[model samples]
Target chain A: MISSLTQAERGAAMLITLSGMVAGLAMAAAGRGDPMGAHGWIVLAFFALFFGLLVRAAYETEAPEDRSLAYYDDPTKVGILIALAWAVIAMGMGLWVAAQLAWPDLRFDAAWSGFGRLRPVHTSGVIFGFGGNALIATSFHIMQRTSRARMPGQVAPWFVLFGFNLFCLIAASGYLMGVTQSKEYAEPEWYADIWLVVVWVVYFVLYIRTLARRREPHIYVANWYYLAFILVVAVLHIVNNLAVPASWTGAKSYSAFSGVQDAMTQWWYGHNAVAFFLTSGFLGMLYYFLPKRAGRPIYSYRLSILSFWGITFFYIWAGSHHLHYTALPHWVQTLGMTFSVMLLVPSWASAGNALMTLNGAWRKVRDDATLRFMMVAAVFYGLSTFEGSFMAIRPVNGLSHYTDWTIGHVHAGAMGWVALITFGAIYALVPGLWRRETIYSWKAVEWHFWLALAGTVIYVFAMWNSGIIQGLMWRTYGESGTLLYSFTDSLVAMHPYYVARAFGGLLFVTGAIIGAWNVVMTIRHVPRQIPAQDRPTTPKTMEPALPAAE
Target chain B: MEISHELFVGFSKSFGLFYLIALSVGITLYAFWPSLAGRFDKAAKSILDDEDGPCR
Candidate 1:
């Protein structure tokens, strides 16, 4: 990795690392008495280690090949490996969290081991750590190929990838140390949030720079989604994480908004994080990889346009639905419900477009596990969006709010749609990035597909049953019209479902382990091969294609 | 000359709805415009040519 960089780039990287080391040391000194000090030490150690490695490789010569002739992919490779590692760790945390709910005695007598602290670790780790890395990696790969241009800078890509991982590390470690801002998805404290802002700005600049240099006259459909994901997520993260830290040296901070405003702001950030982060970005992956793997074009360019703009417009208003039946005004809630239901139109349009693209490629879907992952993901995307719109209705929210039913709904999207699509993209990506003909074991992928599908089914069904039962029991009344079931009654009822959920999580994580091992073995054992038509230096005479609407 | 909180809310309540509706319509018109079909088709088929590597 170090040898690939020119000497000048290496010098610049060293300077950046040195500055980061200084910042870490200052934080450690300033926050000496608090948990913030420990975090400061972690940041210091991380940068120091990188700086040492860079210094060790300072005498190494630059690679002879012209980097601009080829797409820069070293960072994407590292990002994928990092993402898979996070997948195993975070999903394992999720499984542990599930088991604790089933058998409350599953934890040690430690604050970090308790449900409250560990739950956010699982949530943020999977969503931001695993999911965020996958988006960044695949976005890099997809953006370059679709545009036919190299990333504009060498160090900037590495900075973005590693800086983002630094932020994720701080976030996961902070939760274990009880250093949260207490917001749901936006949990890391003020300093960590600030770091992410820096990383994200660089990421956005890098993306636009590459897009600006595209050989194609028209930008691909996938680039639009990736750009939206990068651009909108920055706005959401900045606006939602606005806070006043009590002391710069301490971890505690107060939100800028309070009461109902705070609730609205949090969900707006939260739900759109779902919309843009989880939904749009993965849709970018689906748009590119699914069709590429299937040897087909996207079915409808017009529908793609409609879904892109519709989702961008409609999903923003739908955030208020998360605050239903609360201190929020009814009109706002109604508006949220209205848009959420309307959102189903474009959501299904995209999903249907994907399935329709597979019309002639059904044989591939039958045989190829990687393509099957994407197929099942689209089905889940359609199912969950319908479920989401239904649950957002005021009357339906009444039964679902604060119940395990909400949890069930989340896993349907998270496990079924988000995770399945990510795994599929990874399987598609790994062989290509490494220049291998195919994966090490097709049987493992087949096993993984069945395991993952069965796991998601078992998980979603268990949640549905438990959630409905819990919701009904809580609302139940006896002859005197008083509530019949005690709160413990719901807890007892949840025990069996919790066990099932944990078992499902185990299967999913097991598949992930298998997938990760397959990747490692493929990288180590597979013979290197290059494509005949794929060399970056090849000259092309094809005309650049433009979009119709543009 | 200050825009008070309630005033802003009321303005948004009335104006935001119509503005969003207009935007949605505009997007729809742009997407379905007949002239774009040729370009869109070409663009869709554009990615099919790239396999196993970056486009040249």
Candidate 2:
């Protein structure tokens, strides 16, 4: 199998195999001590030799025409399939956890099934698996479309997909096994972290090589956001995960930073992971798909440049706000709060720009379900950014910091913003890529929109009320000025909100299922052929022509 | 103590007024300058058109 791999594929597979084998040997040798280190070295050496042979064999085959668009469509379709599947899994797990919170008995007595493990699982699944796949798939498609070039290699795209899913599996399983660094978002152990590093480096190279071969005079704004996401995420991942595992299988690791410094580093990684992974990557999608769907030029190109710089400069400092009122220095907290407030300007700028792109296209907003999804996503993006700034304020943090209000705030971005934009992009992609006239049911799309919108509203509002109630009850004093309520009182107060949240989650999940079915029927029933002369031609002024259909 | 606190509050409020005016002017200039320059260029072109005198 390795012998049939291309250079990029072989490089990726070798890195995975070498890292696994080295880690395995390291565990075994550490148990035995002395002279066993050489044995571990020998195993790595053999894999390295095998890797070289695979590369040679891979190069011996006759190379396919590098200019053809045939390879682009296949990988792009695979990415879409992977993204849709991950969306279901991620959202399903999210609803399950929501139910668990609503009724503690829903956990079913399994250790791994509890909210403790499932919380991270829900977060990582949606953020990394669902949202990350959307970013990769859309970036690949948009990059190819904007650059007007074929992707670099046939086999390399498959490597990225397989390697990424494999890393997700490792991270998810490690969370269940209790193999964590005890960090909030960076919980994956050393082994999984290193796996991501290798995958990301290949992704970076793939992006750069394709961009180098572009046929367009000016790179689209979407590509800039995608490239920024890829570059900044790589830096953040390496910095935050600089740790030494006690042993390969020990399930423990020590980060390089300690004390307050460690707290700072963790939030730095945490917040930027949201920035680059969640915010910037999805901004790339918004930049490309929103305008295309609306059939309008972007509202302002200059606003995009200003927003890009503003988000980059301010977001890095805003991480410290997450550690507010902690042992972190007071000045750091003030800096964080100030920058977070500043971040609102840029976030709103992009949101306003997206909304304004639909100025003359409001008919589509009423008619096209896809445009509605994107428009709602922009609205939620504005809402979430404002909420984020508010939560960063010291006084607000006192009440809402540890409450379900924060949970509602996060899902507003993830489910309402990111997932909605992704769905719109995918809806647009399916008809174009698969040559479908229309989806199976416009009625189903309408159902999905209402169900999800209602669910998000019910979920966020319940949490807001519950959060404030809990905050007030906790701070209340008796007639004699003694503490009025026990800590458990707040938990009791949250029960109704938790139940409402689960109901909201159920509606959202139902909508997702409807969407998945709609996509499936469209793919299965739609015709594949477009008449030769009737096919759309690539615009000469924008990008080079695609390869003639075989 | 109350009188001194009130006096300090009055001083702070006046200083805040000054800060807000300066900030508003700065933002207005930043937003409008580029558009103003574009208008100036358009005006200059019209003047050149008049100087060239009904060429056809």
Candidate 3:
């Protein structure tokens, strides 16, 4: 019976299984005096049923291909869209939060509007929502592209996307509702964490099966980064987020680790989260789209290999740098510092390789906004990595730690490196995937490039200067050896920088809106047709051919 | 008072010596291990090779 059913039918069966599990868990939790547990179970059930219905509906009918390319199987396109959308939202939220830091009274005291509440929303939105989506989308795309295989299942692709978004929704909502494990990065309550694990497992399975069916003899460099991302994240999530909720309706939970150990584990997961989610995933995008957009082969394939290994080995140890001068053992701090410094070499190697790929393609950088985005991203990647390494040093950490300087460094990577590369990939993909010959406006692309770049520079530099001044003020002592400036004094000093940062954010958001508009016009106004010749003969090395410049 | 101070100093010196020896050995192993630097070089080359040329 299962064999006779269509792909969509098979998906429905899995969803049914999920629903049953959720119902069972809920019933079990209801037996206890835990309202939170009951609520969690019900939420799980709702998702399962929703997915089940979707599967059933999908199996009952076939989609019209001419309407829009079902890019689920085309990992590259899917990855690009996911990355871009999340990057926009992430950066937007980040700027909002930055503004809040500048003027804490900016937002009216709505339950979800407060900085304490929305900060996690912004962080998770960017890190997991934007960053995580980027990893999954790129990994899927890279995996399929490198493997020379279509994605494994029709429903499976939707499962990854929808399930992931569902989890993000739950986590973000839970934060506002005051349901949390109270962990720094892993703030989602036990139920949300459990749901994520299930979603992640499906993601892993989808990637593995797709890879298994690959036509290519060997996987690409991007695939390695994606695989490492999936594997490391799975391990990290399970280990750090081990917790038990107090009750079902209660948003409280307890971690397995206590005191110093908890602190260590949190940073371990936190910093690596930045590494795998933000760095590794964007590196995958950089490797694949940079060369592809530039129409050039990578500069040195050997350098990519060394950098990957170097980053993987060194980054895990460097998480301790976040705990510099903490109660954590001094030896651990030393190790973190050492590894962080060493990381600079590999990080620079990848950045250098990306830059060099444009050796003969300088004209493309001039004409193609996509290539320009990628190039700018590469420069930011270099800057962020250098700043990160410097901050990991104990002496430097003493000054920059817990300051806006750290915030500046992060945005430099997120906005400048990750978001820029994501935008480039999206611009390159939008026209081709939607069957448009050209973007609605080349001028808009150029406008976005300059505006966003200027915004990023203004935002980062302002934070950097303010952070250093704040750090200095905090450290400065009077002749009597007492503290020179009060904490609020630093806030007063930051007002001008904060206003500049807000202006920069506004510019960046404007650029994003322009981009979104360009994409919409390309999708709607542009004509769509799959020319008979453009269809793949056997699905090996097939891509939509670029139209000649008009 | 002088004799007691000398004996206490001698005990501290012995412990420091053992710690230094252990530290040196650990450093030596980290420097020599193929897992540390060699693997990084190899991984870097592999990725770069896949990029500029055909995947192996």
Question: Which candidate comes out best when scored by DockQ?
Answer: 1
Per-residue lDDT tens digits for candidate 1, residues B1-56, read 68787887788888997998899899889889999888788778777775545543
lDDT of 1 by residue, A2-41 (tens): 9877777788899999999999999999999887888899
Highest-scoring model, lDDT? 1
Residue A185 lDDT in candidate 3: 76
Q: Which residue runs does candidate 3 get wrong by more than 4 Å? A: A1-88, A529-550, B1-56
Q: After superposing candidate 1 on the true structure, give the runs of residues whose Cα lies further than 4 Å from its correct spot.
A: A535-550, B1-5, B52-56
Chain A TM-score values for every predicted structure, listed in order = 0.97, 0.87, 0.89
Query: Between prediction 1 and prediction 2, which has the larger lDDT?
Result: 1
Q: Lowest lDDT 10-mer window, candidate 2 chain A?
A: A531-540
Candidate 2 similarity to native, TM-score: 0.81
TM-score of each: 0.96, 0.81, 0.82
Model 2 over residues A1-550: C-alpha lDDT tens digits? 3433345555566676566566646744663442224334444454455556555566565343333323266666767777778778778888899888777888999988878888788788888888888788888887766665667654566567666776676677666655568887788777668878988998898888777766554567788899989999999999999998776545468999999989999998888888889999899899888887887767766677668767876788789998888998786788789889989998999999999989999999999988899999999999999999999998898888877788888888887898889888888787667767777788988898888788888888887888888878878999999989998988988899989988988888788888888888888986675423211113333323332331
Tell me the lDDT of model 3 at A133.
69
Q: Each model's C-alpha lDDT?
A: 0.89, 0.75, 0.73
Per candidate, the number of residue pairs that clash is 2, 0, 16
**Pairing residues by index, what is the TM-score of model 3?**
0.82
